[model samples]
Target: MSTNNQNDVVSHAINAAQANAEDSQAQQQVEELSSMLQSSTADANVDTSSEE
Candidate 1:
């Protein structure tokens, strides 16, 4: 293969890896946010019940 072809292949691979990393980070953030929301909802429910 030519040098240019090799460079193109490497560039594509790097882009794909970077995209995957970003996707994983986004998923982690979503999970963390979901957990926070669930915890807050539970705490709010408890507080409401205790107020009765």
Candidate 2:
């Protein structure tokens, strides 16, 4: 392959890796938020139930 082609391939691969890393981090944040929301909802439910 030509040097230009190789460089393009390398650049594309780097960009893909960076994107994957960012996506994974974002997914982790989403999971954490979901967990926090579930916990908060459960606590709120308990509070409401106790008031009855």
Going through the candidates in order, what is the number of backbone clashes in each? 0, 0
Give me the displacement of residue 16 in model 1, in angstroms. Answer: 24
Writing each residue's lDDT as its tens digit, candidate 2 over 1-52 gives 6445654665565555556656778667655655665566567657866887
lDDT of 2 at 36: 69
Q: How many steric clashes does model 2 contain?
A: 0
Single out the weakest 10-residue window by summed lDDT for candidate 1. Answer: 2-11
Local distance difference test, per candidate?
A: 0.60, 0.61
TM-score of each: 0.52, 0.55
Q: Largest TM-score belongs to which candidate?
A: 2
lDDT of 1 by residue, 1-52 (tens): 6445654665565555556656778667655655665566567657766877
- Model 2 residue runs over 4 Å out of place are 1-22
Candidate 2, residue 4: Cα displacement in angstroms equals 58
Superposition TM-score, candidate 1 onto the true structure: 0.52
